[model samples]
Target chain A: MSERLAVLKTYKLFIGGTFPRSESGRVYQVTDAKGGWLANAPLASRKDARDAVVAARKAFGGWSGATAYLRGQVLYRVAEMLEGRRGQFTAEVAAGSGLSKAKAAAEVDAAIDRWVWYAGWSDKVAQVAGGANPVAGPYFNLSTPEPTGVVAVLAPRESAFLGLVSVLAPAIVTGNTVVLVASESAPLPALSLAEVLATSDVPGGVVNVLSGRAAELGAPLAAHRDVNAIDLSGADAELARELEVAAADNLKRVLRPRPGTSWTADPGPERMLALLETKTVWHPTGSLGASGSAY
Target chain B: MPSSPPQSASAASPLADVTASDAALRRFLHGLPGVDAVGLEARAAALGTRSIKTTAKAYAIDLAISMIDLTTLEGADTPGKVRALSAKGVTPDPTDRGTPPVAALCVYPDMVAEARAAVAGSGVKVASVATAFPAGRAALPVRLADTRDAVAAGADEIDMVIDRGAFLAGRYLEVYEQIRAVRDVCGTARLKVIFETGELSTYDNIRRVSWLAMLAGADFVKTSTGKVAVNATPANTLLLMEAVRDFRRETGRQVGVKPAGGIRTSKDAVKYLVMVNETLGADWLSARWFRFGASSLLNDLLMQRQKLRTGNYSGPDYVTVD
Candidate 1:
């Protein structure tokens, strides 16, 4: 047992496919249910946030511009990988969220299903929600909803795995870049999920997962003008309100806190649609009145 | 026994007997204390000072407006107008015999048949405002009956207005009961409950009503009846979208949001769309969750689509569908 303990591996932050310690080089210990030290989570800083934003902005164009069908395929790959590692997630979630093994397994299953759900939505959303407009004028008009570029996510605290997946999958599926702040106390599973995303065809920087206190990191992300939206799911009431006000600086889209519920609840279409932008373009129809009409 | 016709008993009430007089309702509404207490001067001043930037996102902007009134299509020429709008995808200028059709055509119990027949095979869906639309002032039985009748008549979706009078009068349980009753009658049909934000009268009320509707099994929580003066605006839409998003987080039941009334142009539609996307994200961008309710909005969107597809900008008259 001592020899096995000696062989325990170290974890690092995943940024743009490369693992690095916090630029701050700070490490914090995360514990299991029995008060035993499980692993060290990177104590991410403002510099890390800036680095993530840079990575996300760099990756935005390629990921968001990818055809919806291709995006869906990449998401499906992530789901497949997650499915392969189901036991790992179940163990980690049980440790992190302090749930029973059976409950943890169910959550892991739901999280994987969530990934597949959003992946399927990538290609079909546009056809279902947008289309050519029938205008009163001779104009080629169309209203298609597009991704709102880079987004910053605050994963829910209680159900770390599913919450993180819920926010990340939707943000990336529609082509927007994401910087996710995993639950501070329960960061291991989030880091592990990142490993799955890394192995999947998900483009680096499309999702940058950081493990740290949401209070320390969330404000900067919410207030960051470059961050188009903030999902304040993990934050407390005070934090949620503060982020809401801070988000107003840029009129950033702020998804307020839903009290008394974890992220494992039924995430219907409403969650996905909340983070999209509809662009309706109008063009002049070049036609003269009755020019070809008979006398 | 089969449930006695829903809302059947409530037909005996004075409110039910009140004639469908738009003018009388307008007058009564105008006479409300708050309606006149806030002067147009103060309102104008308030409006000028507030520069509300539109938040464009996936979830916030998907608005589904419930149109229960078909006055715009009521005439000897209405069927022709409906047919023309359905066939050509354009209408003459309102001042010049052309009023653009809305994102959808919302009709009532009887009119669902006409709207469905007219809009069939067209991309437009035939939405019927059901479960005691506008007032929802009837009994639960009658409201459910109304919903059943509309769905039976082929309403693709049902938009039921909550009992605002009950809600404002502190009858939350009653409001919940009524919405649940209507929801029960919906069966497989989609249910959208109008909050009548103007009647709710404040952001707090709007938020509260939003939650109440979601709690009572509303598929979509909507913002107003265009008949009201204070119609759907960016601020109201923002508040409602936040509620919907929060509700999703809590119940895991993602309720759709619709901002009906006063949305009449492509710009207006885009602004609302931007709000949804920026607030909710990409998950709610589909027509399944989002829609616009305007009598004249779709034509503008169509015209914009045409322009995007073709480099040329065609006049409304020249851009006939057929």
Candidate 2:
């Protein structure tokens, strides 16, 4: 009896809601942990990074302007989509990380729950992070945290699914659009997430995923005048410093990669708050007693 | 193109001799060589692919900035808005004094004096759109009055739209006489004839209008009124560049070409400068012989210029809100 051939999925970079091959038409061989042949992921170039920034900038206005309620629902919907694609992600994760099936399934489950965790914080983060200020003068002063435009993120290499979701969901939940550089080696899961995102309620360009060498893609994104901030969580010691220097050109808000992080641990509101800019408004009412008239 | 009896204007230094009659004008315009559409488009597209970078890019950005006629022609234009725009035109990047001021401040006739006042000592010429502008559908007297109004308000350059209805209908003499009449009223202020190329229909018509406006005494030939779906595309602009280059060759009369609408990026602006340099040579590279009739294009240029200077991307927040 003849054996049936297995259909393999083509991994492409997600930019502006569409999956496109790298502008340079270059692809790299992505392998499993034991050096087994996996798939060739799109080797995104600097131009791809530039295009991603453009898409993120274009999506910024709409996504950032959306009401917190709508943002929360949209993010929650991503969780739902990820939940349905559980089996596929589990297999990919297991293959890429050389993890047992049970452990990979647990990672997928944690990643799905992380989305729900960040989704609920969408409407409440601003309230918890900002409020009416107690000024010394007779005025109504209010401060609110606003998204800091387009954010560039480097998804963690070791913890592909959970770390990618952890960094991405937080930035977007606060109304910031993101251009994410997927992990260098285990990028299959991150690239596959683009499909789930496209199928989900998450608006295209709101979260663009690119799979390539972090060094090749990171420089342009870091130095890009349009990119407002960059989260260097996935970058190594040397690459992180290099990107931080380039990001300084535009004075981008840099979140340096920390030494060690457990993906399963509960992440506080720090990541979301890190990508936000506080806007303070002041309105004068003069001095008022019990009466409506000013004293 | 169909052959015609040699034009009376073709034989002389001055183009004024052709406006003697409508038949003579039509015969001359049709007599000009037909444009090879495929070749023109191919040449324009080929020129657009030139990779301009670094120092060349810096020079192009500055030259393009100096060639822009900073424009604001909305009905909702307030004095405050015009003043703010004029200030931005004068000092494009307030942080960097090295940034050159734009070539001119383009506004409506009513806002010309206001714009002029805002840009007095800055050497930024004030260009006013007259002759019923964008539409050019009014009576001759009203159109003539529109030119008179802008000129009287101290417009350094008067941008007048031709009656496309008359031009397309083959009323060549009528269109020629109207431009000549507006030219007479313009006096010291240079006359820039707007064809609104989107309405002109064909490359043949654009080429013919180019010759017609120049023969009628237009100091510059502008592409559009910025109110149409198609305006100042590279192919159309290249065609204008050729017309101006040939006009200078024929009559020793240099006419500037301004590709006005829909050019919103610095990269697109640089491609145009490359076209001008290649098509008309370095002589027409200055603001006197070339201009960009644009509003949002200034910010893009400024942002790009900042990027070139600092080696980083700039945002809309850094540049003025146009």
Candidate 3:
């Protein structure tokens, strides 16, 4: 234990199964709840955001291309891992959010359950929310919720662990890879969450967490033409407005911050649908269908 | 079991009164501009020949029932009352289950957690009214925060009343931006943008509000808060349903329709169901597609169902169990 503790493993940005520091090589110290030095997290730069976009884009085809059931299985696996680490998160959240032990445990459980909930939704969203469209013509039309490509999330500052998990799990479970800006004041649990994801069967670059000032890193991610959507959850007023404006550059789907609310609320099916872009396909069905289908 | 004065003197004619009511309503609606040209014609075309059924699944039930009112529930002393109603489920024994259990349980920003907890692991979802709710008179920042807080608190859905004051003042863009801002905070939660039809004061306004909400990314367009006297009516439901149907035709996105407020009986619920089925078709039968927003209507539905199943009519006292 002493050897492992003293070894000083350099935590690098997890992108495409490779460990790399920010192109700027900027590192910021993340502190624990008591403001004690915990570890140095990458102060991801604009280039790093771009790099994450590349990694996410690279992984998107294969990840989103998989069957919804397969995605559900992978997400379920992540939920299982998250459940196993519930205690660790409870302790971290207790310290991070200044919540009571019981409250922290409940939050951790809710966060884990959220993961499970989203895991279940991965395969069923289309069935419940999307279906065949009865068009006037002979076209076999259907509408389905599809991943909106690489998503960039700004995890909420409060309710650090749960918020981060809530945003990330939903995004990834729906096959949208994410670049998350971990809560500035509380980045420990986020990195810890990342560690869990690294081991959980979640593909590399499916989620990339960076710990730094939101304005410093978030703007690039929001404005990045490659990114499809920007979830501005933890950003403050000024930052949220700025990100909202920047998101317009690419017309990125922007999710503004929720007012003073925590992520412990019952998440309905809306979050999953929000990150989704509905694609209605119209396939012209002619008279040839009956003859080919007949026995 | 006592019918209300036979709706007329004739006991054999159940729908004679309805026909008269329909005719009167049609005459009243026909005088309004564009209504006679587009709205009335459209509504008549849709409601033609389809008799309103009495069962829970009846088309009339949908039209008549306004599931639950979020603003009223917000002020209710026992926040869990709606949740309990939802917990009881839609039972056939009106006397046993009280009201039919509204289509959904509505609550406030903080109460979403309580509602969700009470209705946890149940079919009924916890809905929170946000974006300053009934008034929609708040800063954009405040409204966005309110919406986000509700979703974060575990609200399965959000009912955000539009800034009618702004809309009425012709600040269309402000109203649009407000809805869009709330839509942003909604994240993954379903957003039902309320037009506050009573305040809008006209069918044309209702139509415009419905289009704005749908175009601005609303998953559902809702009518009235039930607080206002001029709540959801068949006329408003008809207009909004047409708008929703048209929006679907144009965008291919199936936005849901919720006619809330003033609905209080199984009979009312059947009316709304009839309107939806006749106007929107079979696809709108599910809870996801359609919802009633009345608190008392659920009991009425239950009572009616029980009466139908057991051949014994229960009084209102026995039906209003919750």
What does candidate 3's lDDT look like per residue over A123-228, in tens digits?
Answer: 8888977899999987889998889998989888888877887888888877898888888887778877877888877788788877778898887777665688
- Cα deviation at B187, candidate 2, in Å, is 1.2
Enumerate the candidates' DockQ scores in order. Answer: 0.01, 0.62, 0.00
Residue B129 error, candidate 2, Å: 0.9
lDDT of 1 by residue, A1-295 (tens): 4455466757778888777889998989998878778888899997698678768878988998899999999999999999999999999999877789999999999989988999999988887668898999868899887888778888888777888888788888888888889988899988998889889888899989888989888877876656788888889999999888888876778787788765767787766777889999987667555785422
Docking class of predicted structure 1: incorrect
For all candidates in order, state the fraction of native interface contacts they contain. 0.00, 0.67, 0.00
Distance from true location, Cα of B194 in model 2, Å = 0.4
Please tell me which predicted candidate would have the highest lDDT against the true structure.
2
What fraction of the real A-B contacts shows up in model 2? Answer: 0.67
Q: What's the C-alpha lDDT at position B82 in model 3?
A: 53
Lowest summed lDDT over 10 consecutive residues: which window, candidate 2 chain B? B1-10
The better candidate by lDDT, 2 or 3, is 2
TM-score of chain A of 2: 0.96
Candidate 2 colliding pairs = A225-B313
Q: Which of candidates 1 and 3 is the stronger one according to lDDT?
A: 3
Local accuracy by lDDT, each model? 0.71, 0.91, 0.73
lDDT of 1 by residue, B1-322 (tens): 1111122235334223212343432332232222222342343234334323333211122232222122232324355555655444323223223233334566666677766787676455666776666767788788788888888988767888888888787666677667777888788878888888888866556666676677678888778766688887767776677777866764467887777778765556666666666768878776667766555555444544443333223234334432
lDDT, candidate 2, A137-199, per-residue tens: 888899999999999999998988988899999999999999999999999999899999898
